[model samples]
Target: MSRSTSTPAAPATPTTPATHGPVRIGAQARTAQRPTVDPVVSGGFWYDRRRTVARVAIPQGPGLLESAGNLHDLRLAAGAADGPFRGDYPFMDSDVYKWLEAASWQLGQAPDGEHGAAAEASLAEHMEKIIALVADAQQPDGYLNSWFQSGKGDGPFLDLRWGHELYCAGHLIQAAVAHHRATGADSLLQVARRFADHIDATFGTPDSGKPVDGIDGHPEVETALVELYRETGERRYLDLAGYFVDRFGHGRLGGERYCQDRVPLRQADNVEGHAVRQLYLLAAAADLATETGDDELGAAAARLWHAMVATKTHLTGGVGAHHDEEDFGDPYELPNERAYCETCAAIASIQFSWRMALLTGQARYSDLIERTLFNGFLAGMSLDGERWLYVNPLQVRDGHTDTGDDQSARRTRWFRCACCPPNVMRLLASLEHYVSASDGSGLHLHQYVSGRYRGETDRGLPIFVNVNTDYPWQGRITVTVEECPDMPWTLSLRIPQWCRDYTLSVDGVPSARTQNEAPAQDGWLRVERVWTAGDALVLDLDLPVRLVEADPRVDAVRGCVAIERGPLVYCVEQVDHPGGGLDDVVLDPSRPLSAKDRPDLLGGVVTVVGAGYRRRLAPSGWWPYQDRTDAERGDHASPVGTGEPVELTAVPYYAWANREDGSMRVWLPTD
Candidate 1:
């Protein structure tokens, strides 16, 4: 399934779908602005990536699911096949649901943009077959979970703490919503609603007096139930979601931090517990706040987000530093080599951030989304869209012991707990939905990508702005107002947090509206004017290599520095430094750092070359422990050999581990 080193061949498709089943804000939404057209990425970086997804990842999903016994479990639940459940985890069906979601998005996207007409038709055929298989598997009571249905878990709701019954249902409902919205097909939606009805009747609020008093160990069902309410306008569905959200922190699940039931949502000061579970629960909290316009809930959501950013988040916008439970650690306990920044957690972080952006209409939420998308989430999947990494670590030592089958030290075609690859697929397929949003009166560019952006004025008139850029690479973006209302409307372009200096000029001239060559507010450059056709503005953020040092509190890499250019974090792999491995390499900030475009390497990336020295350490001793004052005494352990000058080549962090198996580290020692 590995692809060639070069970019894959994509058919010529000028028109991509404008929206990939964007979030539909109901009247209950409290946000000041919502996305208007779901701005499509018809060209450039994301489009090309989507092309790779359609060509390989999305198409390969069904077969992999079949081979892994995901589909067989579904059939067995339906009494069509006789076998015990497949997969080590109980949540295997979620992967198929995710795959279905991705396939639906691919079918709904720009026709033939990536998939040829015949390919599209074939994909649709497989998608329908899978959908039918899922629909048939549902029990008469509308409950679905291949594991429990296979009689593998005794019965439904019996083991809510360990069983992922609700979690799997959540994914099924999400896939149904996506399918319904994308293709205007309600078959899956109908199945999902039946299950939702069953869940609503079974699970009860604190006052409902239902026999079942437990929530799932996982938090996904809460968010999915809220989305179902948004889709179906069933207040009961929303109430059920609220029930699940409120059920936390009452000693349920024994108040275990791993299950995120230890602290109440509104009272929690910081994010804790399993990273994905905590984020998913908070996402549902955001949804609850949005629909109900609860100020307290909204404040709590924002406060928790700030706490996570300041305490637990990685430089790559990844979370979950503890490897054992895939849990968040104490503030600044980020260990580079042992980081368990699970790929699913990164995706969950994006979901949470996007919801925050819509709820608050602030630029910071999108900022995290951009960082996670470019580095954390992107690093989870291979460039070829075949292999995937369950966890994304910042450092891998030379001869790193890869004990697990799906270890992060190397890419695996599939994981025993394979949630990340299909999750990646759905995100890439629906990426345009996260690019930009509108306030009903103006447009707001969130994540910068080269494409055709469409929004609208408050008066219902459509606005179109064509954007062209090399983006994340060369930072100059050409924006042309193709169509706009005669009335004045604002165009707010985001100045990424990484960008310290940039210039903006309109119609080939410096505009007088600029305020001291800086972003107007909240990392945004706002321009208000009565736009006309063909009016153009050029934004230049000439990307350059930057050396970033971690806070002293981050003990893992306090004296080290991570290389960055624009949105990309860079890492040195052992393959690139054949002479001296990355373990002992040290970067020197005083020396020159250069950025080079190497189309011949790693499928055409802009690599950063830096001046560094390889340290020669004392040979390992039987007793490695040394006194703290040894350096002061000039012991043999200190600087045993001369520092050898080495030219360090760093590729984008997302592109690491794509080559030969060797050492890799993002944060290099600078001392």
Candidate 2:
């Protein structure tokens, strides 16, 4: 909770947001622009995570791929070795491609990565080997997929409904794009283009004169094709991606809601089906809308996003609510202890939100991204980056039953499905790209971090700034302009939705606001002015710990509240309690809460100390129902000297399960 940072200058009334001065915002823009290069995650919180990824996590990938049979399957299919295909069957090849993408991003993280030239060399060497192996595994006609080539499953494209041919191919194309951008190497790009061309020639509508008129069981290929188009400047790939996006809900894949094929993309009222598939499909729609200016697609994406975030989303910003099929449950069906909240679902949510931000220039999109980044997605990976979690639940009960690998509460080195680990790897490696973006006129800092960021103007002139802060832990952000075009351009910083009040200073001088309590329209404070190097702006955001509540209809947590400070959602783990009664404890909201920096706990996090009462409970009857009067129940639940008072400690949800996973809960019963 505590770190050394410059004392921020006070501006405007501390109760009001500074939205009326040079910090005023501009018109929202939806442009077809994305960072083709990495943002400088030069130092601080993100720096450490990215460094661990490059030096530890990513370096460990190839071996995991080999041990998991990804590389072996490719070699066996290529006839370089004699063996059968192996690994997590349906999407085994996708994990390999995901790891390759992760390595490529780390190679491109810096001139030399955080660990220096040696880390760069290791990434390149691994990418070179995998890229060549992937290229060798492709058929002469551009077909690739080790499972079919190794004589498994019914041949290629035989079962489009269940077959993951396109899904795996999509990841391959994405890896190729990342590789090409990072290393300027075309070895993998060539393989991607050939297979993409094959796919284009193979699947289409009857009017397009193609053989197959179906989509894949999974919905990743849509987004992958768009990224491929961006990399290769090939309109055919973009068009192919559009075709796949529109082909959904046509009974091609049995119209299973679980596969996101139950309803047409634009006509759907809200998100449904598998959480990952829905988000991936929406992300593709956002891309198509941005590139082609398709209003219908844009509207659908926005509409579904509003619906999903309003009802289906967890406080941690994770989405999936069901474990059976990893699909979205009914609206207001957000459960705590039974929450699935798959790690892949959280990543998919961030991807979808990022694309939506690019398409709509909306502060709301970035707000969700920040929430997910700090909690849901961050929780998926261990601090050391060597282990990963497949499912992220909001609550883990005491004496929780041990499940199989994929559903286990504990983080593992790898899983049988193995999607979340590499999914996390690729996201962390490429995280810089998501931190900030430019739309040719203004620079938008959606997620704050300490680093050097570059934006651009319409003439392609670069605007660079060195940002310094401990952010997420502290509210002070100092953006010092390092370079600019000498002309005016907007510098917009997102005021997170969770922020209630803030102070702003321009050029170290206090600036006045319009006395508005929040930003005029949305949660972004923008400033447009002619700039020179060394000009600066400082914004000190209020990071008070506040209790949050869900809708009354979310029954599972109707009378409960969750804790949050800034963008981070906090949870109470049983390990931090040790008195052995987390379930019996009820928060005493009347007691004052304090925030203290715990450098010795969970790799140094800000801990919230609060008071709670372990309510004495009577044994439940066999029927588990009480006929007691309302007064009797109220007396039993009261926290006024009727229960044992206990001091409670809460930590960031992302840091849970890292020490010892006994029990953890975000929402606590309060009285």
Candidate 3:
């Protein structure tokens, strides 16, 4: 439990900064004037506000605060003070400290740097201690792993299949990158680079004479390498990333041993095997394709994206099937009660989709990200933002909850393999990073929200974009060009695939509009106008109740149905219907589902009221063939169904299980 405050060496290019020229500060930054109704907000730029801040703010803010506070208290209770280590997960003290580092990185990047100083200090000290521990434990070849180095002596790199060496490295790299970006402290970055270099030398026959195929069984190293390359722009880093992608599906690195080696990496379409691993690999492939401009790799990524959206994805854009291994079950086999929508998996899926949107400029990727952000991702955090659910299931059977039965499938305060909490923290902390992207032609406002972007445009123009909105809860964004070069640049605003009716306005005047436009073709409304300081653009998208049906092949639902409004999916919990069997219930789609502002619920949950039926007992022996006589049959019959006027309350699929403990079902069987 040691912490170091020493800053590591700067990157190899000490004098070179990532950005070109000097950073521009907006001179005339002003709050956008409120516009009249009748506009649409489309894009992921401000979508994270609804997803991460509004929906998950309660859970993430309070949950991490409480967890970290508890860990701090535990460390104090153990008589451990002054040193740099915190308590690990609830039980084992394995690599739980890594989660703390990751969480610190995330807190440092959060809005207004809420807990930035403490988080940065904690990460720096913890990383220093970890580096020392690694140095002391290494075998002098620069190879370091806490699990293997603490007298495990298993081997230099044994159990690549199940061992979490690379997975741990990936998390460390993420923390390092986040810390470096948030604080410009290269201490942990230097340690991470050294570890990455050691990994490169040991595996893949780079430095070692071993001809072993080099690939982490878990597909995270690829993503880390891609991020590293992006940060440093080292060709070898990109080459190493490609090496991982190339090795995938080649049967080179224990084919199918980790479920990634079975099919060629290009051939693996649907998100198979481990949910987190699958999404991470897809993200890396997308990064590689974008950075290298490799058509083959892009095509592979495209095929996989289609397969995942078409078959494996849930209504909430959640992936993974079996609750057992948190892995994929089958194509379109999404089960409401049995789903294992790991929070980390949802975050990874969003990351993958966001990268894809940037790479291909396809609105479908943004669509997927929107769906997951509002539903699956939001469901991971609790209503108060203090507690978190590791497994986000669509339904839960009453009395027999997954909590006590299956440890991995249950929602615990903390876990020994504690990656989800900190992963969520980082995602929320760096949410703005996923909001917008620019490639010079025009500013691509991928999401809609109230924020500001001050960066050099692709054309080297000093561009400043200020977005103002109250989104997800409301859809109206006023984007003002606070500062830009006096040139006609295309301002591309993404019209979400879900939005059916939208109106656009430029310079406070009504402009062209479209209805039910194809998201991929016309998702973006290009406003090519002579822009100057104080030019305003407004977009308003209609939000209506959307009835979403599952694939017919999904046997889990049968005649069941679910409801969706805006991007949020609605489900019925048994608590709302006492003694009402979900099987006997049915949704009256004709009934209108309204958005009620319930401050008591998670960021104001949407409630639905519907009608259904109930079952009552009948005679016992009416249909008994062998043992029943006519008189017996007349007196005792089988159970009879009774139709009663039933009113049931339904909450957003993500908001279920927070209320009274009861049976919950997203897909209720229709009689």
Candidate 4:
């Protein structure tokens, strides 16, 4: 079924005509039109974090990249400085580009307080310096890769298997687009277009004069080219994106598993190979599906999404189970201690799911976005926003070794091949984009972050809705209409899957609809009425602590249950448990769980308290495999030997390891 841009009740929203900071692609299609509120306009949790990124994270990124030799490589390539390339990885250029991208977004935001001006000025200075260095490094033909520029590689695009030429170019284009949108300076965009033109001239079939039919070892350029297309309104950039997606699965690069080209993308059902690469490919394919209106591609994306959620995902919303290959294992192969759920992979999942939500306006897609944002993606960075984790394990065993960058036992200041830190910085800087979306009829509240919404109705009438609430901690959201058309319009609020009971009222009158059977449009409570200034809509979502269990097929966590309250996933860290390791803890479902505001701890989180049991250790030095029916005679022993009643305290999973790094477990064995 082709997704017609036209809506049933309202006209389709036009493509973004003005250059904006956070451009939501495919808004004109059936998907919701994403109108991001300025970071200055939003307050509370998200606003505070955005301010931290602008003040600390963005400023700190360049120094880390400089220490890691990414900035040095660029200057060496540009002949502005003299030194041998200092980085071990060929993809170091991407780190610089990502940091620049973060800086660009930071520069673009309007500051809400006295600290805003100084931070924006600093970001502007950094953006200019990086842009100058990057432009100087570019070849006359628009080729720019610090690795290739430093003469470390034979030539440009020579080794698609290991060389990240296209990957670097992709990041460069993204940074350029962001810089252009933020500052309206055409310099970076012009440089990017030149490099993109060079790519177009060098790759593709003979008839197009760029006769190279191969895909990148990494999948990013496809999405970047599409973004460039959106910026320039050029047809060729979209074509190039399509070409890259079509060229996969031909065994041209590495066969199926290593590069995710094993089977043709349109025919493949499950996500395979490197988790980050697979997700980027699918995300770009989703962009292609909408841009070209290809139903087959759309269906393929849907299938891969279903496969991932059903079999490959963890309770914490992370992916990739095996550490050795940084690849996903067989179905239901998720493990806790040995998980390789790279922080980059989690961010990639968010990117893909966001695109999916914007493409179809499906509540489930936004559902995944909410799951990922609070758990997987947020867990990548520390509360202070300086430290980062490459791998987020659900269970951290006692005495676990810190495996160098790839699978660290705890968050690190920087990694050898650092990708997650800058990536996290960029995501947090642009988080306002994911708060809410404007469907043709009205606004749909996706994630319940406190923010403002500004957009237009189908008839091009101005609409502004001011939202105030503390979400994910308290479930009460109050939205007041500030401006809107006089005609009847709908306001849709997501009924989060975890919200079993909720109350909604417009102008202090209770909704006639009753529990569980209220009609919803795509999982949202749709309220349509004639508009008026100062109209208030109040929603109270039940926020209760619950114990969730995984499917029986998930062998690693068969009898274990995870604690959750609202959008936050809860975990028990060693600091919270005075008695023993978290591995031996078992939760009792019959006992009630209570939530408390911990203002003094972990940057102000609502901690969950519950009754549980701790395993009592049997006497050691008996036998290798002995039964413990009686202490005198040993035959066999049960995994859950004996339990002692205890009171347990759990903190948000993302807030763990900030105080101390000890045993932590999200899924506890249920007694």
Mind giving the per-residue lDDT tens digits that candidate 1 earns over 169-278? Answer: 99898888888877778999999999988888888865777768679999988888887877777888888888888888888798988988898887899889899999
Comparison by lDDT, 2 against 4, better one: 2
lDDT of candidates 1 onward, in order: 0.82, 0.81, 0.61, 0.79
Per-residue CA lDDT of model 2 for 117-167, tens digit only, reads: 776786688788888898889999999999888888888999777679999
User: Model 1 clash pairs?
Assistant: 17-110
User: What's the TM-score of each model vs. the native?
Assistant: 0.94, 0.93, 0.80, 0.93
Model 2 TM-score on a 0 to 1 scale: 0.93
lDDT of 3: 0.61
Q: Top model by lDDT, which number?
A: 1
Off by over 4 Å in 1: 1-31, 113-115, 513-518, 628-634, 637-642
Q: Which stretches of candidate 3 lie over 4 Å from their true place?
A: 1-140, 205-212, 403-410, 454-458, 519-522, 578-583, 615-642
- For every candidate in turn, the CA RMSD to the true structure comes to 4.3, 5.7, 9.0, 5.9
Task: Write the residue-wise lDDT of candidate 3 on 1-671 in tens digits.
Answer: 11111221111111111222211112211111111111122233333332343234322333454354433333332333334333332221223334434444443432323353554455456445543443343345555454344333365467676656677676666656655664667766776788788787666744547455567777777777777776777777777778877777766556662457778767665567888887788888877766665666767877888888888888888888877778877887888777888888899999888877766655677778888977888677655444567777787665553545323334555554556665665565455556666555657777665566543444667677777765665677788888888777777788877778777788878885544564447267777777889989888888776666677898877666777766667888777788655645656555565656554654455576666565333434555444447434544332223356577677877676666666777776544
Which pairs of residues have clashing backbones in candidate 2?
A: none
RMSD (CA, angstroms), candidate 4: 5.9
Candidate 1 lDDT at 214 equals: 72
Give the per-residue Cα lDDT of candidate 4 at 254: 61
User: Model 2: runs farther than 4 Å from truth?
Assistant: 1-33, 36-38, 111-115, 514-516, 630-641
